[model samples]
Target: MPVAIPLTTHDLNSGGFAAARARTTARMTATVMDLTREIPNIRAYALRTWHEATQRLAEDPEATTAIRAERDRF
Candidate 1:
């Protein structure tokens, strides 16, 4: 995510630009950190959903039959 900070000539001359840059950098860093912290949970959810789908395909006889029928049609 890009943040647009509007800077005036006075802000640049008076050194306010540096402070604004630091603040924006800190905010972006914190947002990235927060997203990184959720990686494990996100991975777990994805894996769990994949496993459930696999299990369902394995256990459902109708689905197995349908897949085999489709394959034989080729």
Candidate 2:
């Protein structure tokens, strides 16, 4: 006689897998947003540095003329 197999042991619930995937997607989205949040701050700092350098160059005419002469060489 052949042995009988139990079907209850093969129960596969897909709902658990879907829930786990949704949680993972949400966490990854949050992480990506957090990582890019500093972009604006970095841009602001660069812009401030550029403005200060421009002001300093404007205050010194000799440096500005030298920069212009060098710029025309390219």
Model 2 TM-score?
A: 0.41
Sliding window of 10 residues with minimal summed lDDT for model 1 = 65-74
Candidate 1 TM-score to native: 0.58
Clashes of each: 0, 0
User: What are the RMSD figures for all models against the true structure?
Assistant: 10.2, 9.7
> Can you give the lDDT of residue 48 in candidate 1?
75
Whole-model Cα lDDT of every candidate shown, in order:
0.74, 0.69
List model 2 lDDT by residue over 1-74, tens digit each.
99987645234335666678789999999998987998899888777766666666667757966456444432
For candidate 1, write residues 1-74 as lDDT tens digits. 89999977876856767788889999999999999999999989777766666666567757965556444433
Best model number under lDDT: 1
Span of ten consecutive residues with least summed lDDT in model 2: 6-15
User: Residue 65 CA error for candidate 1 (Å)?
Assistant: 14
